[model samples]
Every structure is written in structure tokens, then in C-alpha cells.
Target: MAQQQRATETKEALINAAAVVFGRQGYRATTLRDITREAAVTQGALYFHFDSKQELAEEIIRRQHTMSSGAGASFLASTESGLSSIVRLSGELAAQVLTQPVVRAGLRLSTESADDLAGAAAAPYRDWIGACRILLERAAAVGETREGLDLDAAAELVISSFTGAQFVSAALTGSEDLLERLERMWPVLLEGFVRDPDHPVLSSTSDLIYQSADRVA
Candidate 1:
């Protein structure tokens, strides 16, 4: 058990190191030697855990997918309203992307090297879209989303918009600004999608929402 635990730790350490290196230098410029050096492990040790750099990269993507799914599930479970959950989840995701260097790098790499990464990064996104569709359908059932809103299409749009925004923010102002911008944008986007008769305009209180989400998360 101890040996297995240690191996797991080492693998995680290497993944984290790779995320930093990949985020900073990009996948094309990164090498196994760089990952090993960053992880403070020998090249042979890295190979013992992962056969190739591509494998390591895929593992990173897998880990990220697991993390994102867990986050989404937790948020959905906690909130009664789907739209509210999405608004809250968006903030949570933004905070994570800004704070976690590994996650941020993985997202950036996924977009920049979609072709190079082959379908590694694509599956996670598809999974997220499916999750969003389910959530939107639920929200519609609860009268949270607009009537006649195409659940799948709206979900895809929401994910794509946020993903694109994150990419732009990363490229332009960095992760901090990305989170700030997401907080601002969430209400505006939700307002149009949500079926609130009383509160037609989704009020932007990102700070308050973020604080609440942090507590819930």
C-alpha cells in the first residue's frame, strides 16, 4: 500500500511539473527531460511511470477531466436550480483556472495543440458539453431556463463562450483577469438564458457569488 501510495504521489508530482513546464514553454517545446528535471526525478523513473511524453500528457488531460467532472457534479448536487449551479460553477471554474497553474496550462494546451494532442483534449470537452446539456434540461424542467431553449445548443454555447473567454483572457490579461471577466460575464449570459420573470436582468455580483461558491465548494 505504501509503495502504491508513493508511486501515485510521484506520478502526480510529475504531472504537476509537466503542467508548469507545458504552460510556460508549451507542449512542442517541452521534453521528457524537462519534466523529469522539474519533477526532480530521473528519466528512468519517469519512464517507469509513463512510457512516453504523449502518455504523460494524456494522463494530465485525464486528471483534469476527472477534476472538472467532480467539480461539476458537486455543484449540480448542491444547487437546486441548474442555472444557478452553472453561474456558480462558472465562477468556481474560473477561480480554479486562475489559481491552478496545471489546470490553466492544460486548458491552454488543449486549445493551442488540439491537433497535436490528437483527441486527447477533445473528449473532456465533449463530456463537459454533455454534462451541461443535462444540467440545462434540468433547469428547464424547474423553470429556470427559458422556454423553447435548445438545451444541448445552449449548453454548448455556454461552454464554448467561457472556454473562448478563458483563452482570450489568458492570452491578453492573464488568469486573474480571466476570472474577473467571467464573473462579470456570467450574469449577463445567464440573464438571457434563464427564465426569470421577476428578475429579467441577471444581476452581476461576482464577488458575492464567488464567495458563496467558495464556501459551497
Candidate 2:
């Protein structure tokens, strides 16, 4: 039992160490020695768990998708209006990008290694967009959005805006201001989509941003 636990811990440590390095250095610039050194494990231990750098990165990407999609699924199951859930979900993801090393690393690796990873890296984006479409559909059913709004276009816009906001925030501030940027982005974007801009849930957007930030603090 102790032997199995130790091996599990070693594997987790390797994944975390690799994520931190990949988040900071990008994949091409990173090497197995760097990850093993970061993990404080021998190359043999790393080899025991993972055969190559790409395998480790793929694991991180898979984890990232799980984390993100898990959150989306939770919001979808909630009683909140879809528009409200969408805002809250964006804040939640922004918080993850700000505080979670694995999420940050996963996002960076997915973008950096798009060509290298082929279609695997794009899975998160596809899932996110699909979730957004479902949310928008719910919003339309609830009259949260303006009538005749194109659900597909709205979902794409929301995801694209979020992707751009996070990318720019990462480049300029290392994602320190991601929540702040999200807090600012949603109101203007929501103005076009919501039936009434002054709705209570819509008005509380900034509060949602702070709420997400406070969770990490």
C-alpha cells in the first residue's frame, strides 16, 4: 500500500512540475530534464510514468478540458438563467486561469502546440463552444436574450471574446488582471444580447467577478 501511494505521489508531482515549466517556458523550449529537475525526481522515475514530453503535455491538456468542462456542466445544471450562468462561468474560468497553474499551462500548451498536438489540442475550445451554445439556447428559452438572436453566433462571440481577453491579459499582466478584464468585458458584450441591460442579474456582473476572485483569495 505504501509503495503504491508513493508512486502515485511521484506521478502527481511530475505532472505539476511539468505544468509549471510548460506554462512559463512553452513546450518547444522545455525538456524532460527540466521537468524531472523541477519535480525533484530522477529521469528513471519520470520514464516510469511518462514516455515523453508530449505525453505529459497531453495529460495536462486532458486535465484542463476536464476542469473547464466540469465547471460548464455545473452551471448548466443550475437554476440560474443561462445568461447569468454564462457571466458567472466566464468569471470562474478567468479565476482558474489567474490562479491555477495547470489551467494556465494547459491553455498555453494547447495554443503553443496546436500544430504539434494536431486535433487533440482543440478539444477544449470545441467543448467550450458547445457548452456556450447550450447555455444560449437555455437563455433564449427563458427570454434572457433578445428575440431572434442567433444562438450559434452568440456562442462563438462569447467564446472568442473570452479567448481574446484572456490571451491579452496573459501577455500584458501574466493573467494577474484577468478577472478585472473579464469584469469589464462582460457588461458591454451583454448589452447587445440581453433583453434588458438593467436586469438584476446583468447588473450584478461586477459582483460575480469579485465573488470568483474571492474564492481563490
Candidate 3:
């Protein structure tokens, strides 16, 4: 039992250390030695749990999606309106990028290692788009979407817009301005497809951004 617990701790330590290094140096530049030094673990210990750098990076991306998607699902479950949930979930994800190193690293690595880790890098975006599609479908059922709105296109647009917003924010300010960016994005992005351009949810954008920014600040 003690050995099992120690192994778990060591593996977790390696994952976290790798994430930090990957976040800073990116995937191609990061080395196993760097990860071991960051983790304060021996090479043998790291190899016991992970076969190579690629495997460690893949694990980080997998856990990143699990954490991100799990939170999105929770936000979806708790909110009453599909539109409202989408807004709130976007804020939460932006906040996570700033606050969670693993998430930030995973997202960064996904882009940096896209060619090498194509499937792992792409999975999170695909899942996020699917989640948005489900939310748009729900909004349509409740008459929150415009009469001629294409749910699939709307879903893709929302995810893609957020992706661009977050990416730009990260590059400009290390994501310090991410929530604010999302707040600015929603109005212009949602104006076309939402049934009501001036919904209460729309008006709450500033508050939502401020509140989430405060939490992650």
C-alpha cells in the first residue's frame, strides 16, 4: 500500500513538472532531464510511469481535456438556460487557462506539438465544439436561437472565436486580459444567431468577466 501511494505521488509529480516545463519551454524544446530536475525525481522513477517525453506530453493533454471538459459539463448542468450556460462556461474556461498550469500547458503544447501529437492536440477542440453544438441545440429547443440559425455553424463559430480570443490574449498578455476579451467577443459573436440581441445574459457580460477575472486574479 505504501509503495503504491508513493508510486502515485511520483507519477503525479512527474506530470506536473512536465506540464510546467512544457508550458515554459514548449514540447520540442523540453527535455526529460528538465522534467526530472523540475520534479526532483530520478530518471528511473519517471521511466517507471512514462515511457518517453511523448507519453508524458500526451498524458498532460489528456488530463487537461478531462479537467476542462468536466468543468464545462458541470457548468452546463448547473445553468438553467443553454445560452447562459455557454456564456458562463466560456468564462470559466478562460479563467482555467490563466489559473491552471496544467490546462495552460496542455493548451500550449497542443498547438506546439500539433504535428507530433495531432490526435491528442485536436481532441479537446473537437470535444469543445461538440459540447457547444449540444448547447446550441438546447437553446433552439427553448426558442433562444434565431429562426434561421444554423446550430452547427453557430457552435463552430463560438468555439472557433473563443479559441482565437484566448490564443491572442495569451500571446499579448499571458491571458491576463482573456476574460475581458471574451466579454468583448460575445456581443459581436452572438448578435446574429441569438433570438434576442439584448437579453439579460448579454447585459451580464461585463459582470461575468469581472467576476471570473477576480476569481483567477
Candidate 4:
């Protein structure tokens, strides 16, 4: 029992260490030695858990995606209003990108460079677009958006906007300012989505109806 618990802890520690290193150095610049050194574990221990650098990165991506998908799924399930749900989803994701190292690193690795991992690396835009499409459908059904609007296009735009905002913010501020930028981006998104911009159901960056965070995530 002790051996199993210790192994679990060691694997978690190594994964976290790798996320921090990958978050800072990116996949191309990172190495197994660097991760093992950061984790304070022997090379043999790393080999016991992860066979290669790409494998470790894939694990981090998987963990991060799981965490993020949970947040998104929660928003999808709990919200009463479609537009409000969309607003909160953006905030939630932005908050994750800003606060969660695993999420941040996974996003970077999935999108940035993967010639080595090839198709093994994930590009998250399509998944995110699908999630947003669900909310947009809800919003339209609730009369939050214009009737017969191209929801697919809107979802893509929303996904692209979030992606671009993070990429640019990471380049400029290492992503520390992600939520702040998200706060700014929300109003524009709201303007584009709501049925009545003047008297809308919610503000773009208003408090999330769900208990996700303090502000735009």
C-alpha cells in the first residue's frame, strides 16, 4: 500500500514539474533530464513512469485537457441562460489559462510545436468550437442571439478570439494578464452575440452565474 501511494505521489510530482518546465521552456526546448532534475527524481524513476519526453508531454496534455474539459462541462450543464453560459465559459477558460500551469502548458504544447509528436499532439480549437456550439445553440433557442444566425461561424470566432488573445498575451506578458484581457474581450463578444446590445440579458464580463471564479476566468 505504501509503495503504491508513494508511486502515485512521485508520478504526480514528476508531472507537475514537467508542466512547469514545459510551460516555461515549451516542448521543443524542454528535455527529460530537465524534467527529472526539476522533479528531483532519478532518471530510472522517470523511465519507470514515462518512456520518453514526448510521452511525458502527452501525459501533461491529457491531464490538462481533462481538467479543462471538466470546467467546460460544468458550465454547459449548470447555466440557465445560453448567452450567460457562453460568457461564463470564456471567463472560466481564461481563468484556467491564467492560473493553471498544467492547462497553460498543455495548451501551448498542443498548439505550438509538434513535429516530434506529430498527430499525437492535440490542437484544441475543434473541441472548443464544439463546446461553444452547444452554448450557441442554447442561446439561440433562448432568443439570446439573432434567429437563423450562423452558429458554427460564431463558435469558430469565439474559439479563435480566445486562442488569439492567449497567444498574444503569452507572447507579451507570459500570460499573467490573461484574465484581464479576457475581461476586455467579453464586452466585444457580448456585443456580437446578444439579441439586444442595449438591453441584453447579461454583461460580457459580468460575474459568472456558476461558482467558477471571482471574475472573468
Compare the candidates by TM-score and give the number of the best one.
2
Candidate 2 to truth, TM: 0.94
For 32-125, candidate 2 gives per-residue lDDT tens digits of 9999999999999999999999999999999988887777888889887888889888888887887788999998888779987766698888
- Expressed as tens digits, the lDDT of each residue in 57-80 for candidate 4 is 888888877887887887789756
Two-way lDDT contest, 1 vs 3, winner? 3
Predicted structure with the largest lDDT when compared to the true one? 2
Error of 4 at 170 (Å): 1.6
lDDT, candidate 1, 95-174, per-residue tens: 67766766777787787888788789898789889888877877888787777888878889889988988888977876
Instruction: Kindly report which residue stretches of model 2 are placed more than 4 angstroms away from their true locations once superposed.
Output: none
lDDT of all predictions, in order shown?
A: 0.77, 0.87, 0.85, 0.79
RMSD of each predicted structure = 2.5, 1.5, 1.8, 2.4
- Which window of 10 residues has the lowest lDDT sum in candidate 1? 199-208
- lDDT-superior candidate, 2 or 4: 2
Cα deviation at 17, candidate 2, in Å, is 0.1
Deviation (Å) of 90 in candidate 3: 0.9
- lDDT score, candidate 4, position 211: 33
Cα lDDT for residue 65, candidate 4: 77
TM-scores vs. true structure, each candidate: 0.87, 0.94, 0.92, 0.89
